[model samples]
Target: MSQQLIQGNEACARGALAAGCTFFAGYPISPSSEIAELLARELPPRGSVFIQMEDEIASMGAVLGASLGGRRAMTATSGPGFTLMQEHLGYASLAEIPCVVVDVMRGGPSTGLPTSPAQGDVMQARWGSHGDRATIALAPGNVQEVYSLTIEAFRLAETLRTPVAVLYDEVIGHMREGVVLHEPTPEELGRRTAPRAAFSPTFLPYEPDENGVAMLPDFGRGYRFHVTGLMHDERGYPTSDHVKVAELLERLERKVEPAVAAVPPERYRLEDASVVLVAYGIVARTARAAVDLLRREGIRAGLLRTRLLWPLPAPALTEVSSSAELVVVAEMNRGQWALEVERLAGGKTVLAPYLKAGGSVITAEELAGHVRRLAREGVAVS
Candidate 1:
């Protein structure tokens, strides 16, 4: 439990250790490879497992496999690797496995920039895995956040009995900043409760207690419950019945939505604003700096820094945007998460996209200029 200057990637690895992650399976890719390198060396000594699979596909498969074995598991990857993991992600979602996936987004439609930073995968992290099932994700704005959010990811996964994503840009993924490493406090929240006892001769996997989070039984713990990606009933048996599918999906979503009440993030400063910038990850941090400069210049602009990217936090954003005359979204990628914001905000708000491609950072100076230019021209973002 100490603070030190560390890279975001290292913070993520250390955060995993603190979050009770005992298994990691990853494929080396830019931006996120450092997390793997550090964990490979760090985890074994701590009685954890680190695996580098042949590719991102197997990397994802291994983590899911390990999670079933009663270990807190994780995986890290960049955009390409993340893209490849979509199928397994869907599997993790449907199977209701508890684990974390950290995606350090680099610029890309496909390998657009390896060593650069981008927030291109914001939408993908939420919906890239094909399904109607809700996925939760967190976007960290700094190195310390990478540490904190990784723990949150696992906590959400275990509590909801679902896979969760920790979203980061290459900048936050690689940038060196101060981080406080420590074990999560009991009051900090954590994993879902497992079954007190193993299954009987007839075991049911989909049976959930009052909260709707099914008790996850550890594989080979004398528990013989069958798990499959197909839609299943409370008995864990494949159910083609319409009522079974409807009920299963409803339970999956309900388990997560209730947990959001405990994971509120900073609003930055949207208290009384005419114009606001909605941002996440590194761009949000830079945008925070930009907002300060705007305030100093007497502009009533504010920032909405999202800690929770998925589940979208619609209620909070709607409340913040309601006070704004216009909302500008800054991201390293072209309006990915911004689109989601727009959908949630409806048409009551103006929209401007400060988008960048390839690999780069959206500096405070650049954002300040954008705010000034738009304000001077009286051009509402649309």
Candidate 2:
């Protein structure tokens, strides 16, 4: 293990390298440019490929191409660039091309904030692209988690045969922290499942194994197959068959279900508490601190910091919130994820939101005060 003080963006870049990523394609964007910058400096020296594409769309295309060619590929961008890559992201989902995308979230609908931090991209990461597809998104609250989760993103992408997203706010992306970087063991560095039999005309490239994941072959491995954005059959050819299309979508979502358990939420002080706070990314750091402050005030407040953003972690969330009288979903956005919590929450618990958008972070003092007032009044605080 090696300890060093490094920026979260730099940690993400290093994590990519540690995950055996050999190709990177991205356009420089604020809050996320450091990732591309660091990879450009480090990748070539390590005999890996790094390219600055003309735009986010092209960058995603290049990454898909590289991944198909049997390379661990990735890209990094902020909100605006991430929007442009949505089309390609959808394609990757349907085609089952394993890749990683790092979104160092700023604020946005359209370039809302360049340098400031925000958690507005939570919903976008899961639903920005068209169609009904499953998404695997990881949120890291600190620099150390940024490094570790970046590697986990690649591991999930490879093993599940899908694109994985690593999301963190600008605060975590640029914040400096002392991180103990550990090299992943062989088991930690998962491999993409390959076809068991020799490729031939009868081979179905999209045929799923017992795990519901398709064994996709590398492009130049003499396994000729189609790769398209349209719904595909077992042979990887375009298909409009209603049964096959429905099955494809169902299988796509079912295969990624393992991620819910793979990346569980961090339950803090929730053992016996009446008030529960929920948060993720940089906001989770503040929420954790707020729990301590509330506890000191005899508020019996606890926290549920989620690292896995997608697939909802419904079971864990339901179990935790069920025991609490109040569940406060705090975030640095206009209640994006709070909506999900509301949906999953039982009727017994009162759900409140602590939302602050426009690039400002939710402070511990602010969150603790809200919880304190809510506890006294026995009502939801906006």
Top candidate on TM-score is 2
- For candidate 2, the lDDT comes to 0.91
Which tens-of-lDDT digit does each residue in 222-323 have in candidate 2? Answer: 888888888989998999999999999999999888889898899999888788899999888889999999888778888999999897889877986688
Query: TM-score per candidate, in order?
Result: 0.95, 0.98
Angstrom error of the Cα, residue 346, model 2: value is 3.7
lDDT of 1 at 100: 93
lDDT of 1 by residue, 1-382 (tens): 6679999999999899888889999999998999999999988998889988999999889999999988889999999999999999889888899889999988888978888888888878878877785788888888998988888888888878888888888888878987778779854537566776566866677788788888868788777778999898877788799988988888877777854565576776677777788888888888999889988888887888878877878877787667688888898887787787788788877777788766888988898888889888886432
- TM-score for predicted model 2 compared with the true structure: 0.98
Query: Which residues of candidate 2, in runs, are more than 4 Å off?
Result: 380-382
Minimum summed lDDT over a 10-residue window in model 1 is located at 258-267
